[model samples]
Target: MSNEAMQVRALRGRVVTPDHIIDDGAVVLSGSHIAWVGTADQAARAGFGDAVEQAQTAPEGGYLLPGLVDVHCHGGGGESFPNAETAEQAMVSVLEHRRFGTTSLVASCVTAAPDVLRARTRVLAGLCEDGELAGIHFEGPFVSVERCGAQDPTYIIDPDAALTRELIELGGGHVVTMTIAPEKPGITGDDGVNAALIEGGALPSFGHT
Candidate 1:
């Protein structure tokens, strides 16, 4: 038999499924999909044509929550997302977050030399071809220096179309959300640039506050 079918996982305690939760719920997986879920006491009684006996003996567990998705996390486990100097470094941070139940995430750049940002983010975007890196969060280069927090002031600048496009390409064309300061005026907060980013498939999130 295939390894997936041979293995069995029974998480019995507080089971939280996408729809609902069962107090003493249990989920039995015959493979990747959940084969069964119900109260532990009713597991064997409900009847499994061939696996009744085995299901009855599956161990009881603690809280079971399917992996998590953190859309706005800056970093975790001592790793800083904005500090990733290379694609590998960014991946390291991603893996760290995954190990701790963050099934999904976005990289938040803390501001740096445009060239460096492009180089690093492009690699990250390319890596996302494998579905690891979700997207890039540009939190600088267009942010108000007056509100700079954990970002390099030297790299801050007004947001523009050319630079924005360049960064998107650098990120392998995978810009998801960017934190921009729309109140900064001029090209720093141009609507055209925002529209281009949106059309490019990258979501824009305004944040000066």
Candidate 2:
């Protein structure tokens, strides 16, 4: 079948596939679903496990699952979203984690105005579509100033569904996750704005107020 239909197998070193360890585990992948998993002997009977026993030159080590998926990381390497500012410059931050095994990455942005956010999303969305990026995450611009972490308080605003929808659309499908403080004390003008954003294809995650 298609590679996408194939399973995830990490026989030798480290593989942390989506979850815990496999140890000397044998992983059977079918499509995106794990068809089977057990010991080396069990996998040998069914076919597929650590080849350590079958090898003499390979590293004498335990079997690692698959790599990890960092859903909340900012930029890559020493580059950060706020520091990088622009999406183009932001890529350096993205590639930093790919080496160790970050298959997917979300380009997070600071609290900026609608136009700036749109511009950043436009670039990040393109990167994601081109396979260089995975998704875009907006952490602020809708957070509570009272509880703002390291983010700039000047960019904080009450959650607005209209802007949120626009931002997502601008990012294309590259925009998937959003960290919003739903309890923020704004959003007074529009009707059903919250529902529109929460339901309009964006995964809204509650953040600190």
Candidate 1 residue pairs that clash: 122-170, 159-188
lDDT string for model 2 (92-167, tens) is 8777787666777766777877777877777777787888777778887877788888778877776777787788
Task: For candidate 2, give the lDDT of residue 184.
Answer: 64
**Residue 125 error, candidate 2, Å:** 1.1
Residues 46-76 of candidate 1: C-alpha lDDT, one tens digit per residue: 5543453343442355566777877766666
User: For this target, which candidate reaches the highest lDDT against the unseen true structure?
Assistant: 1
Error of 2 at 192 (Å): 4.8
> How high is each candidate's TM-score?
0.76, 0.69
Q: Candidate 1: worst 10 consecutive residues by lDDT?
A: 49-58
